[model samples]
Target: MTTSRTVPSVSVTYARNGGSTKSNELGMRVMQERAYEKRGEQYLLIKSPPASGKSRALMFIALDKLANQGLKQAIIVVPEKSIGSSFADEPLSKFGFWTDWTVTPKWNLCNAPGEEGGKVNAVETFLNSDDKVLVCTHATFRFAVDKFGVEAFDNRLIAVDEFHHVSANPNNKLGQHLGEFIARDKVHVVAMTGSYFRGDAEAVLAPHDESRFDTVTYTYYEQLNGYEYLKTLDIGYFFYSGSYADDILSVLDADEKTIVHIPNVNSRESTKDKHREVEHIIDALGEWQGTDPTTGFQLVKTPEGRILKIADLVDDEASKRDKVSAALKDPAQKNNRDHVDIIVALGMAKEGFDWIWCEHALTVGYRASLTEIIQIIGRATRDAKGKTRARFTNLIAEPDASEEAVTEAVNDTLKAIAASLLMEQVLAPRFNFTPKTPQSGPVDGFDYGEGGYDPEKSNVGFNEESGQFQIEIKGLAEPKSKEADRICREDLNEVIAAFVQDKQALERGLFDGEHAGGETLPEELTQVRMGKIVKDKFPELDDEDQEAVRQHAVAALNLTQKAKEIAVTGPDVEKGNTALIDGVRRYAMDVRELDIDLIDRINPFGEAYAILAKTMSEESLKQVAAIISGKRVNLTPDEARELARRAVRFKQERGRLPSVTSPDPWEKRMAEGIAFLARMKAEAENA
Candidate 1:
């Protein structure tokens, strides 16, 4: 009894919780609480998901600094005019905050009609006066800065929302202005953004500058998984053979609250006629009741004579623009918020536009950017009164082999699929892990050779009571090497999977590209000789990329070996489990949904190894550094206990165990012994 729409969709699954509404009443939300904790820091970057209350968090911190911390002024800058409303004044006391957030109407220069000079003059007036908060668009801020210069706003707090608009490129005006502000060192900055990681896939700030700020990341998982009403969000793709407008009726629900985005004007798939498409959809719905003047809703009569209300944001008339925008925001004349059935928009409602009742966000075209897709998806994720679930459906055209643009269309579709998979990874819960057991010596029957460490030999398990996912690894210094090994192995696996999946991989001749016909190597020699072949094949790749290919080949060989070895262990032994050996440690994966396919699907940011290398957490960096420094060891219980006894004896004899002032060999050894003893005791107690 399932329909065509249900059959063609791919299910997107992720971890979620029952939901939380503590923030709905105001005061400080979970994320805002995190911000308030870091209020004392000079530079703060709040990386949070959209609709997670970053604006209110900034208000709380800015007010605290302006009223109590002696900051001269606070300037709030947004990327667009509609976003400026997010900073509108709020009665804080009613919401349990100490003071109200006040923005004078005169200083709020968003969407004010005039040229660059007029906006600059307005900024000048605000700066000259005693206004504590001035809100303006990023364009206006740029013009004002050009006219008044950076020194005019010295000692003030500049809080930039949607901080991803800034990038390393010199052509990006806001980015350049932020760099200058950082260089001057006169202003304190609080940069906030929902799309900080993937916008343009470019550095938002220079490495040295980005390092100066203390960052607080509120992941998409934390926000959605903690919601009170909404439980699940499904992101799926539906492909059609013809025009999206013609195929629209197959996937869209007329009864559901939905926003339908037509194809971009420049897209090859676009008919270049949005109005006709709108008309076609309206005709399919029912009879036309004409536009309602009172509420600005376009009323239509269905074949059943049922009237359907639509908000036509694509209307080009300048006069209707304001009315349409207002109606889109509220959509209710007498508190009937859900009166509008469908909102057909061109480009108006993508970012920073809040409509709480939307249940479906439908887009008809390929958008290459993952950041843009995430923003579009966020529109339907807002928790509402009766909304229990949400969906994001992408309607893309399937490639036609007979068509002239088939090659390009096929490539674009593959890229979109890759981006969708990557988004799932980003939105899903991350795995965080620490060593659960101390490393023991090498186990019997286990081999590190090409035929040794197979999938069958690998041991992985989940402890329901403790909520831990455990994996067994070889060698003692396992704790120190766990993170590095996991990262290297996973990254290498991804590269190999991409190599196998991509048609371009063979066309590029990644393997045997430069090799001429010669004597065939033996089957066993193929694995042994693949690295040199890969390195020689892609000579155009830089040293790093070349090295990655070689690493991928090696990793594939090792994985095959593991799988074979695990097979030899027999079916009686559980998968992913091996007998405990000396120098082996048990590690726990803190992430959920660890899948090989998911790992391979992250398509953006060219090399997986490079991205992981650049974005490792401080603790992970320390672990990697320690492993690289060759300082990790597998200590036995006897050794750990003896070290502890010796440390105690030393302290009693000398009144102090060691001194960090000097790099003396004996002091360093004593310190290491004492630390190892403490670690062993802690491990034993936890066990």
Candidate 2:
């Protein structure tokens, strides 16, 4: 049997306050109520976690638009037919709302039996008719918009669900069409998404277009913290060797209600024969009894003599798969915890697939898209009675030095690390940073540790009710422009997503320390690398604005890492929901003062490397380090220019240029950058 080792990258505990699930007088949950308050805005974006009632939120807003806002109609656009069911009719009046959300059966194109191209006539018919709401897939809407110009859909509220599917890339038809509609300025638009950033590093909307929309953000910390159940959520990955089927039992607990996503046929980890793999997994469990006729679930008796009802969605046979799919989606059984034990799927049960009792989400290989990973994790995050813990596990193949695919395996490993880092930021509490001036004081709602806020040093204050951290860092660059401030408040995660995904930055940060040639200074990645990424991501911003964003993003990432290190290593490992909060306070108290320079000196990936050492085999770890170290890269001209810019800032503040002989590593690195850039200019002049 192949050995299986799993390490949880992030295990967050929540408060279980039950505030999110509780509804207001209008029967709107916390997030939904917040979104409803902004219904008057013509352009709005709802960024909330899954199972946070985004569908109901849209219903509340869409109904208001129809009855009160004087809008002609509401078009709900979803990425797939499965997600289209989210916009189904709701009896809002029964829940204290003034009106109901109804989409006429004929106008619900998702349930209709025709191709998207053939649905254009229905869209035209609905526009000409008095139907208040229409629901369809993104494909159907794209085709309809192509057939009918932007002018044809005027005076309507177009609500896009899974908004991340629409990209700012010119090639993205839906995104292009949405831009056209915004330019026309004739219709109202509302976009909702569980994850705002895409895994492929593309913007969902252009800067100017995104700025037009008033954003309503409900972070994962807030959503999970306010839950009635699911107190802890663990995100982890396992590395396995040889066929995954042989090692499946190591991580796949038969007691937990899990959804195992087998690898795609094209993925390197796949054995190429999916059917055989499924049979192997079943056999590994125990004796297989006959299939249940009604649910079409395969009955397998585990070693403990308990029968397991597993839904096999990997089968290509349409009749068999459809029966299993129908049974899984049966609304009557949604609340029944024992309805299904495990689900083995290939491409289904990811987006919009709801299984509230799922204790774990397990996948065989690394998913290329971070958005996909987030959605898969969401499947297990639903709050169910007695289910206090939910976890997501990724089973990846370990790299082998003898294999030709070693390089490919290394890339997958890096991508998996990137995904873990991004998820950590997403799951952490929201950070509100401010410069530490002489007049700095504690915010109104925040709790400033045991001794209260200090006047002489930086303070870390946490507001449990708001699920936010008010941190005062000395020398933190404050954003001047409104747009820059908005980004620092709302889009720091998006900025971090780009930074962690950078190939060079991730490579160096992960494996280029003492094991490799030279030690990578924290400022090299935090200042020069992140600075370049921010400038490229938002070219519209001025130099000062760009620096402000860079500082904020770096501080957020590094502080979280520092906090996690303290929490995990501290005596009280199970500190419950307040672990992170306590960790931050402890870190602040341990240091003399919290400053931007001290924060930048921290390697954001240090905690990650420590965890990696504990989980991966020493030999395999060395192999990965060797593979990455083989491709040692010199500083590029772009990096040199970015560092030189930093050197200039250093000179302005310290009254002298950074010295190569300086004891400080950051100062020496800046001096080296200046030398590198000067040498390049000299060589260019000679050429």
The model with the greatest lDDT is: 2
Compute the lDDT of residue 588 as modeled in candidate 1.
Answer: 13
Worst 10 residues of 1 by lDDT: 579-588
The residue-by-residue lDDT of candidate 1 on 19-63, one tens digit each, is: 323653548877888888898777899988888899999999999
Name the TM-score of candidate 1: 0.67
**Model 1 lDDT, full chain set:** 0.60
Q: What is the C-alpha lDDT of each candidate?
A: 0.60, 0.91
lDDT accuracy of residue 116 in candidate 2:
68
Q: All candidates: CA RMSD in angstroms?
A: 16.8, 1.1
Give the per-residue lDDT digits (tens) of candidate 2, residues 557-670: 998998899999897588788888898889988998899999988878878888877777778888988877778677788988898999999989989999999998789888
What's the C-alpha lDDT at position 665 in model 1? 36
Where is model 1 more than 4 Å wrong at Cα?
1-20, 24-26, 331-335, 434-687
